[model samples]
Target: MEIYQAFLVALVACFGKFTGDIGYFMFDRPIVLVPLTGLMLGDLQQGLLLGAELELVFLGIVSIGGATPADVNMGSVLASAFAISMGAGTDVALALAFPIGVLLQMVKMLIYFFRATTMHKVEEYAEKAEFDKITFMHFGHCAIYVSVYGIIAFCSLVFGADAIRSIVEAIPQVVMDGLQATSNMLPAVGFALLLNMLWDKKLAILLLFGFVLSSYLQLPVLAVSIIALTIGLIMIAQDRSSSKTAVQTTGEINEEEDFFNA
Candidate 1:
């Protein structure tokens, strides 16, 4: 692709990361953004397939306590673009995406660390009730986010793809195989992390139930979700019914005591 085209693609892709948390656009999701990146590169099918795979890889990665394992946005955009541009297969693309995700995560965290300084400015505004000034400070912070995530993505998509393709092409067979192997392991890692986060002794039965539905019965995810929701609603209704019964019983006991007193 031409330089301007790559830049545009990159700029749009950055929303998958930089501006992702800002609004309803939801460009940060791999399922949504990767395909768009692929469309920009004239290979929407490949992009969608790659996006699905990446989503699985990063599914367990969430920002708990204000830290994520990787930069989901930059990873999806750059990996899909670089892979499609080079005609690399899915495995290689996944391998490339993993490292880039971690790298970009570090970059983002560094920017965040520095951005914390601006909190003082926000505090100063709060003291005086200068709401407009505080809002402007927020805009300035967002501009910083755009500069870091968006500009970096634009540069990478426009200028780095060809070089990355060249380097990937030159990698030795053994190292390439290792990367492919690592790619295969990523999904399992993601799932395991998710399980660790969600696991609780009290809720173990729910996990087991889901496992049975998925592994033994081979139910579709939508079906499983519907069943789970139904169970939750039923439980809620039962709880409400029990509370009502207890209230009625108490009222009846009070009436009997009044009759005795009269």
Candidate 2:
């Protein structure tokens, strides 16, 4: 019954937007999707807890252009579902989910390749000036992509979780320890992704400030985020002020030139 529910949840999640590849991060947001999966399994609280941890780990996972970094949707759903069924806590579930998320990323890359094939048809419609056809083609491509996601999600819900639980249960203590070690390393992967996006020489000072506040002062993540936002606002305000002053100076110089000409 839970399996059936998971299938419905996956279907709604993937196809509700009428496009499956609705960009990985938005639909795959663990906070939103994990709770839904939990509700389906009749364990909403556990789902929320697991989802929160998974969210922290994958907070920096993003799709840039044609690249799908990792499949958070599959990871969160599978982890939450398995954990709930096995009565495991969020930490244990997260330990299991991180590696699965990395594997799912490869599946997403394959999906990207499949979607690319439809682009030629889209180009043909553009060349023919058939705007409606182009729209239809794009929609069709989205449908296909979503269908693939839905199918994979449904299969995992139906067949994979139980199999995974069996294998996990059979693993030696040392292997479980190894899994925990790998899980501990996953945050670094997420941080690396963030660094790739956010690393700028100009922003080095901001990063240092955040690190000091969090590490030395022991500030909460929320507090650090708020402080960072405030700093960003101040910087933006200064830039705007500088731009306004420059514009005013340029206008004054223009006026002086006109007077000299007159």
Candidate 3:
């Protein structure tokens, strides 16, 4: 990639990273980030497909409190950038994404550790009733995050892309094939993880229904989704109707009791 292209890619990465710091706009998601990176890299279609694949790969991974999950946004951004720039396929992107994400996670942890020190200053400002200073510290930290990670991404693209390409080229075809197989299975694993977290016997039927539609009927995803949505709306309406009937019955019983007492 050219320097300007790399710079633009870095900007995309920074935007992804900064999404959380600003608010939960969810621009950091691989589904969003990879396509933007791809657009910057001049391969929107490839980026879109890769983004969807990467989204599945990172689907169940989430950050909770101090436990930071892998940096999916950064990883996806770089992976798509590399893939598009090299005219490579999803296999290479998948092979590179996890390590890149983990590396960025480490960087995030370090950044958070150092950024924690600013809390002391924030507390001091809070005590002094210096609201402006406290606010500055908050936004200033966000700015720092953007600048630091943006530079890291910029450097990675300009410096590491060639090195990575060389390494990938040196790998044996058998290993590349193995990576491709692993990549193909990752979406299933991601879904499994999601199901493990959200497993409910009552809802399992719905899951099976969707599965049957997709697998046996060979229905498209949109059709299955619409069917599910219709079912959900019907269920919700039934529940509301039941509640309303119960309320009416209770009201009638109360009126009867009052009439008898009078």
Candidate 4:
């Protein structure tokens, strides 16, 4: 790509990723933004694949209590673009992306730490109940965050891509093998995290049903999802029926007591 084109691409990619990051924070998802980045880069297929894999890897990852998790947006955008640009496979891209994502997370944590320092001013404003000052503080903090992201994006475009490609090309076969090995192991990590979220005893039967359907019956995910939806509807109907019966029984008991009192 020409220097001007590269700059344009970088700016657009950065803005797309930034938008995605904001969406992730609000909607708790990064998948929506990855495809947009890919589309901007003229590689929608690679973008979709990268997004899906990243989503799986971070399936159980959540930001709770102001904690930062891995920066999925940066990871997906950088890795997907690099992968498509370099003609690398999905697995290789994923292998490279995971660590980069974690590094981005660290960067984000540092940003958050700086933002925290500014929060004291907001707190002081709150003490005076100056709502406008509190609002300005929030806006100022967000502007700083977005500006930092834009700078990173611009710098990465200007200096990072060629260097990254050179490094990947120069990597030894042994190291490449190690990356592949790590890539293979990453899905297990993702699954383990998902298991943590879905370990409920009450949902054990449904889980088993899905497992059996997928593993033994070899059903497609679409088929399994449909079955699960049907099961959910049935269960909901049964619960409603039971609730109605309970209400009727309670009403009869109340009537009986009233009649006896009369």
Off by over 4 Å in 1: 23-27, 66-68, 201-262
Error of 1 at 225 (Å): 5.5
Per-residue lDDT tens digits for candidate 1, residues 55-135, read 778878777775677777678778878888878866777767778989998888887888897799889899999999988
Cα lDDT tens digits for candidate 2, 1-262: 3667767767655743342254434655777777777787787887787777777678787667777665665777777777787887665577667677787677666866887877888788889899998877667777766776678777776777778778778878786677667666766787877888878999898888899999999999999999989988999999999999999999999999999999
User: Measured by C-alpha RMSD in angstroms, how accurate is candidate 3?
Assistant: 2.8
Which run of 10 residues does model 4 get worst, by summed lDDT? 21-30
Score every model by TM-score.
0.77, 0.77, 0.89, 0.77
lDDT of 1: 0.80
Which candidate gets the maximum TM-score versus the true structure?
3
Q: Give the candidates in order of lDDT, highest first.
A: 3, 1, 2, 4
Question: What TM-score would candidate 3 get against the native?
Answer: 0.89
In Å, residue 103's CA in model 1 sits off its true spot by 3.1
Candidate 3 deviant stretches above 4 angstroms? 235-262
Candidate 2 ranges with C-alpha deviation above 4 Å = 12-27, 59-70, 89-114, 215-218, 258-262
Task: Write one digit per residue (lDDT tens) for candidate 3, span 111-135.
Answer: 8888997699988999999999988
The TM-score between candidate 2 and the true structure equals 0.77
Model number with the top lDDT: 3
Please say which candidate is ahead in lDDT: 1 or 3: 3
Global lDDT of model 3: 0.89
Residue 64 of model 4, lDDT score: 76
